[model samples]
Target: MPTITTTDGTEIFYKDWGTGQPVVFSHGWPLNGDAWDNQLKLVADNGLRGIAHDRRGHGRSTQTYVGNHMDTYADDLAALIEKLDLRDIILVGHSTGGGEVARYLGRHGSERVAKAVLLGAVPPIMLQSDTNPEGTPLEAFDGIRNGVLADRSQFYKDLSVAFYGANREGSNISDGTREAFWLWSMQVGVAAAYDCVKQFSESDFHDDLAKIDVPVLVVHGDDDQIVPIAAAALKTAEIVKDATLKVYEGAPHGIVGSSYEQRFNADLLAFAKS
Candidate 1:
């Protein structure tokens, strides 16, 4: 149980494996560092260091009653990186983690980061605004918050189906994978998970995306239902200069550790080596 104590006294559990050029992974909402297991192993096998932390209030991390927003999330990551004295890092984030990485570079700058990758990420903003009319509606997130408050366990179990595209036609997600997602979601604190619904859906990343100067790879599943490509990855790639876009045909949102793990890992390793 390796961990780091944040400035606010929250203990963040993390996994660090192998050694070489470093790759730091930030996972999606309601998931712990375990979500990056496949990616971490792949990078480690390729002679690169892979590190991932359970965000505060999730998994083995402290279940604090406050400070669950994006800013605090980024700060906590910064503390982890600084405490470990890591350099020349490639920051890879998935779903909500993508927003965390964007906000991290926006606030902390890219001095230590060499590259960034966002997979099925929520960025540039996920909520509909005057300028961004194609974004997901607030009602959707509100429904999620309500679902968590009403029956968190059942809510997560149900979400796992869509998260891994288990319900999609031609989908072949294993029962074990779906169960793993549910178990991970259930590990998160209800309060933190509820607050994060707003954090990921409402928090605007326009400025954050603009601040990213390093090489960025934005990967999204064209069939993603959680964060639609029109509002998320598509818009994100446009906002981040020199960002490369990779659209996974027929892939679902949970691509990294699920059925697309091999392809995802290969792409990630190639990017890390480039």
Candidate 2:
């Protein structure tokens, strides 16, 4: 098992494949690096190296009693990149991982990065605030927290329906699909899983987005129920200086391994090479 030890001694498990310009990936909350398997396979087959790390306290990483927030998350990413001496990198992030990418660039600088992609990402902030009144209500996030504390197993299983739009009309999502989501989510440590709800919901990324110097590809499903396009992808595209936004009509938050898989993979490959 490949891993990188953070400054604080967290052993972050990672998958590294292929050999070319590197594309480092970050996964969403409550999921390990394995959530990006499809993307990893696609990228590696196309001659680009794909690297994804399980965040601390999630999956094979250390389950620590401290640092379960964005700052530490970004710093851990930086430590990984530095320790591995990776450069001219393309960073891809999904959901909370998008915030991690933004925070990583803002906090540590993107001197090593070449380009970036944010897919179904949460950014600019998810919780409603005075400045961002269009954001999701605090009650919704509170409900997420309640669900995590009340019944995490059931919560992830239930969340899979909306996450993949399985409940949508004419949807063909399978039972195995939902079960895969549950399995990925269950790998997270309870403390990290619980604390990440707040991290993903409330971490403001306006300044961080503004700080991004590399070209970005922002992809989102128009019907994304978890991280709504109106609040996340659209706003992130607007904030990032050079971003090309792609909206998949009628698509759900989880696009990889779905009908949108080929389209997304092509776009990602094109972006990485561009």
lDDT of 2 by residue, 1-274 (tens): 9888888888999999999999999999888898889899999999999999999989989987689999999999999999889999999999999999999999988899999999999998998878887789999999988998889999999999999898899888889988988998888888888899899999999999999999999999999999998889989999999999999988888864456778898899999988
Residue pairs clashing in model 2 are none
List where candidate 1 sits over 4 angstroms from the true fold. 256-259
Instruction: Please report, in order, the local distance difference test score of every candidate based on alpha carbons.
Output: 0.91, 0.91
lDDT of 1 at 100: 95
> Model 1, range 172-248, lDDT digits (tens) per residue?
78888878888999999998998899899989999999989999999998888898899999999899987999998
TM-score, cand. 2:
0.98
RMSD of 2: 1.0
**Pairs with backbone N, CA or C atoms under 3 Å apart (clashes), candidate 1:** none
